[model samples]
Target: MKNLVIIGGTMGVGKTATCRELQKCLPRNVFLDGDWCWDMHPFVVTEETVRMVESNIAHLLTGFLDCSEFDNVIFCWVLHEQRILDNLLSRVNHGGFAIHTFSLVSDEAALSERLSRDIAAGKRDPAVIERSLARLPLYGELDTVKIDVTDISAAAAATRIKDFLAA
Candidate 1:
C-alpha cells in the first residue's frame, strides 16, 4: 500500500521546501500542492467560495486515491482546524496507507516577520497573511509531529522530516 503524507502549516513555514526535500528523499512519491487547487479555480474566494472549493478538493482527492499510478503521495495544505483534517482523512481512508502528518509552527513575531518579507517580495498579500495568522491558533492539538521552523533552514527542516519518516 502507498503511504500518504500530509504536510500542514502556516504560510511561509517552509512547506514548499519541505515538499522538495521529501521528493528527494522519497523519489517515488508524487507531490501535490494544495494551493494549486485554489489557483486553478476561477471564482472569487469568499467564505462560501472557500467552502465550495474544499468540497471540490475532497472529490479530487477521492479520485487520486482510487488511481494506482503513484507509489506514495505527499500532499501539502494549510490545515487550520481538526474538522478539516478529519474530512481529509475520511476521504483517503481506504488503501491501507499510513497517514502521517507534519505541522510547522513559529512564534507570532517570527511569522509576522516572514509575512512582511513575503509581502515585500510580492509573494503574498498583507491581508492574506493577516487572515492566515488569525486562523493559526485554530489548528487544534496536532496529533502528529510538530516542527517549529522559527530559526531553522529549509534543509534542516527537511532533514527532520526525513528522519521522522525513516524512524
Candidate 2:
C-alpha cells in the first residue's frame, strides 16, 4: 500500500521545507502543496467552496492512485480543523493508502514574529497572518505529531521530521 503523509501547520511553520526533505529521503513519494489550489478562484471560504475544494483534492488523489509512478505521497496544507483532516484522510484511505499526519506548531510570540517577517518580505498579507493565528488553537488535537519550530531553521525542522518519521 502507498503511504500518504499529510503535513499540516500554520503559516511560516516550515511545512514546505519538511516536504522537500521528505521527498528527497523518500524518493518514491510525490509532494503537493495547498497553495497550488489558490488559483481555483474565490479564495474566500464558504460551505460550497469548501466542498468544491475537497472534490478537487479527491480528484487529484484519484489520478495519483491510478498511476504506478509514485509509491507514496506527501501532502502539505494549513489544515486548521479536524473535519478537513478527516476528509483528506478518508479520500486517501479509499485508495488503499496508509495515512499519517504531522502538524507543526509554535508559540504565539514566535508565530507573530514569523508573520511580521513574512509581511516585511512582501510574501504574505496581514489578513492572512491574522486569520492563521486566530485559527491556531482550533488545530490542537492528540492525534497529530506536533513539532515546535519556534527557534529552529527550516533545514533543522526538516531533519527533525525525517527522524520522527524514521522512528
Candidate 3:
C-alpha cells in the first residue's frame, strides 16, 4: 500500500522545509506543496480563488495518488481547519493508501523568531508574522498528530515523522 502523508502548519512554521526533508528521506515519494496551486502574481484571496486552489490541489494530489511509480505522497499546506482537511480528504481516492495527518506546532516565541528570520531574509512578507501567529492556535484544534517543532531542526522533525510511520 502507498502512504499519504499530509502535513499542516501555519506560515513559516517549517511545513515546507520539513516536508522537503521528508521527501528526501523517503524513497519513491513525490512532494506536493498546496501553495503552488495559488501562487499567482497578485496573490488574491477571494472565495472563488479559494475554491479554485482547493480544486487544483485535489486534482494534482489525486494524479500523484493514481501514479504507479510513487510509493508515498507527501503534501504540505496551511490546513488549519478540520473542515478543510475533511474536504480535501473527501475528494481524494484512497484505495491503497494509508493516510497519516500531522500538524507542526510551536510556541509564540519560536514562531515569531522563525518568521522574523524569514522576513529579514526576504523569504516571506512582514505581514506573515501576525497571520501565522493567529493561526498557530488553530492547529491544536485539528484531529491530526501534533509535532512540536519549537526547538527542532527540519531534518530532525522529518526523522520523527519517518520513525512514526515505521512504527
Candidate 4:
C-alpha cells in the first residue's frame, strides 16, 4: 500500500529538514515541499494566487500519488489551518493510500532559538520568528498527530515518524 505522509509546521520548525530525513528512512520515497509551488518573485497572496498555488500543489501531489515507482509520498508545508489541510486532501486522489498527518510543534523558546539561528545564518528573515511563534498554537488545533520537536534533531524526528508509520 502507498503511504501518504503529510507534515505541517510553522516556518523554521524544520519541516523541510525532517521530510528530507524521512525520505531516506522510508523505502521508495518521494518528497515534496509545498513552498516550491509559491516560490515566486515578489510573492503575492490573493484569492487567485492562493487558488492557483493550491491547484499546482494538488497537481504535483496527485502525480506523485499516482506514480508506481514510489511507495511513500512525503509532503511538508506551513499548514497552520485545518481548512488548508482539508482543501489539499480533497484535491489529491488518495484512494487506497494510508494518509498520515503530523504537526511538528515546539515551545516558544525552542522555536525562537531555531528561527534565530536560521536568521543569523541568512537562511530566513528575522520577521519569521514572530510569525512562526504566532502560528505555534494553531498546530494544536489541527487534527493531526503532534510531534514535539523541541529538543530533537531532524533525523530523530524522522525516526519517530517512521516508527509511527511502522506501528
TM-score of every model versus the real structure: 0.84, 0.86, 0.98, 0.98
For residues 1-167, what per-residue lDDT tens digits would candidate 1 score against the true structure?
66677888877777888888778877467787888777843547788877776776677666666668866688888887777788777755466566778888877778888889889999987786787678667553767678888898667777888787778
Q: In model 2, how large is the Cα lDDT of residue 125?
A: 86
On a 0 to 100 scale, what is the lDDT of residue 14 in model 3? 97
Runs in model 1 deviating more than 4 A are 40-48, 62-69
Off by over 4 Å in 2: 40-42, 93-96
Model 1: how far is 99 from its true place, Å? Answer: 0.3
**Per-residue alpha-carbon lDDT of model 3 for 38-88, expressed as tens digits?**
799888999999999999999999999999999999999999999999999
CA lDDT scores, all candidates in order: 0.76, 0.76, 0.95, 0.95
Clash count per candidate: 0, 0, 0, 0
Clashing residue pairs in candidate 4 are none
Relative to the true structure, candidate 2 has a C-alpha RMSD (angstroms) of 2.1
What residue pairs are clashing in model 3? none
TM-score of 1: 0.84
TM-score for model 2? 0.86
